[model samples]
Target: MNKSTINLPENTIFEVLVTTTNNQKPHTKPFGMKIQDKQVVLTLFPNKTLNNIKNNKEFLIQFTLNPLIYTKASLNKLTSKDYQNNNILKEATVILRLKVNKIIEQKNNDKYGENIITTIFSTVTDIKQENIQVPAINRATTKIIELLVDYTRYNYMNSNQKTSYINKIIESENIIRKTGNKNHNKSLNLIKKELNIED
Candidate 1:
C-alpha cells in the first residue's frame, strides 16, 4: 500500500471512525487520524477501545466529513441504534476492515524521557465503495469552513499562508456547489464576503 494514501490533506482534518468488538458488544468511536504508509495511526489513550483492540486484534476504520455524526461520535454520545440502519456507514467513501497483527507499547523513563515505539501493523482485508450518496451540502461545507478556520487559528499560521489557505477553501466550496450542493454555496458566499472577493 502506498504511504501517501493515508496522508491528511493540508488544512483539512479527517474524522476517523473505528469499530471494535468490546465484551461481545460493538462500539464505535471517532478519532483524528493521520495516514502513514497506507496505515491509519491514531493516538488512543489506554481506554476501552484500546483494550478491545489489544484483545480482539481486529477493527474497522472509516472516514467521513459528516459534522453531526462527527460531533456525536467524538463525544461518545451516539447510540448503537443510530448506526444500525444508517447510510453513513454504508455510504462511506473509504472503508478499511483490518486485522491487527502487532502491538507496541510505550514507556516513559524516570529522567522525564518518553520512548516512542510505533509500527503496530494491521492488514487490510476489505475495501469497497458505498452506493448511498450524500452531497456536500450547506451544513457539511459550513462545518468544513469552520474546521479550517479553527485549524488555522490553532496552528498559528502566517498571514500569507492564511490568505492562501482561505483561497483554497473557497475553491473547494465552489467545487461542492458546482456539484449541485447549495449548502456549501452559502459558506462560499460568506467566505467571499469576508475576503471581499466580488462574485
Candidate 2:
C-alpha cells in the first residue's frame, strides 16, 4: 500500500508511537509527526529516538488509541509484550515502515526556549494494515499528549513553565474525567503521581 492507504489529515501533526532498534534492542517513544507530500516528517531534540534513527535510518510508526501504551512509553516502562516482532507496537491499528529521505537541521524558538531540532523526512517504504477502525477524536487524548510532552521537561522548566505545564495537565485531567476512558485516566494518574502532584 501507499501513503494514500494510511489516510491521515494532511499538514496536521498528530501523535504516534515510533519503534527503533539499535544493536537489535528495541526502543519506542511517543512523538508527533505530520505528513507533507506523502512524506513522514518530525523534528526531535537529542534523545534515544533521534540517536537510533541517526544510526539506523529506519523506524516503525504506530497509530494507537491506547493511552496505557502512551503512558508506558512516556515513563520508559514498555516491556517485551508491548511489541510484537521487535518493530511493531502491539496496540497499533495501522503501521508504517518509513525510510529516511532527508534530515534537516534548524534552530527553533518556542515558549520552552531555543534549541536545534533535527527534522526527519522519510518515504513510506512499507505498510501494515490492521482491522481499520478509525477512532473518534477526543479532546482528552490530544490534551493528554501535550501534557505528557510538557511532563517530560517538567523538571527542567522554570517556575512559569512549570505552572503552565501543570495547568495544562490539570485541564487534561478535567477532560479525561468527562471524556477519557479508564485507560486514559490511568495514564494521567500515573503521570500525576510520578510528578508528585497532590490530588
Cα lDDT tens digits, model 2, 58-122, are: 99888888878888898988898878774677788888888999998899887668878899999
Local accuracy by lDDT, each model: 0.55, 0.83
- TM-scores of all predicted structures: 0.52, 0.89
The 10 consecutive residues of candidate 2 with the worst lDDT sum are 1-10
Per TM-score, the best of the predicted structures is 2
Candidate 1: pairs in clash: 3-37, 6-35, 138-183
Put down candidate 1 lDDT per residue, 1-199, tens digits, no spaces: 1222333454344557777776766677665555555565555545667877878887877765454444344445457655543223542456677777667677634222344433346766666445445644454445554543343242345677667666676566645565424434544554455557675
TM-score of candidate 2 relative to the true fold: 0.89
Off by over 4 Å in 1: 1-13, 85-91, 108-119, 131-199
lDDT of 1 at 65: 48
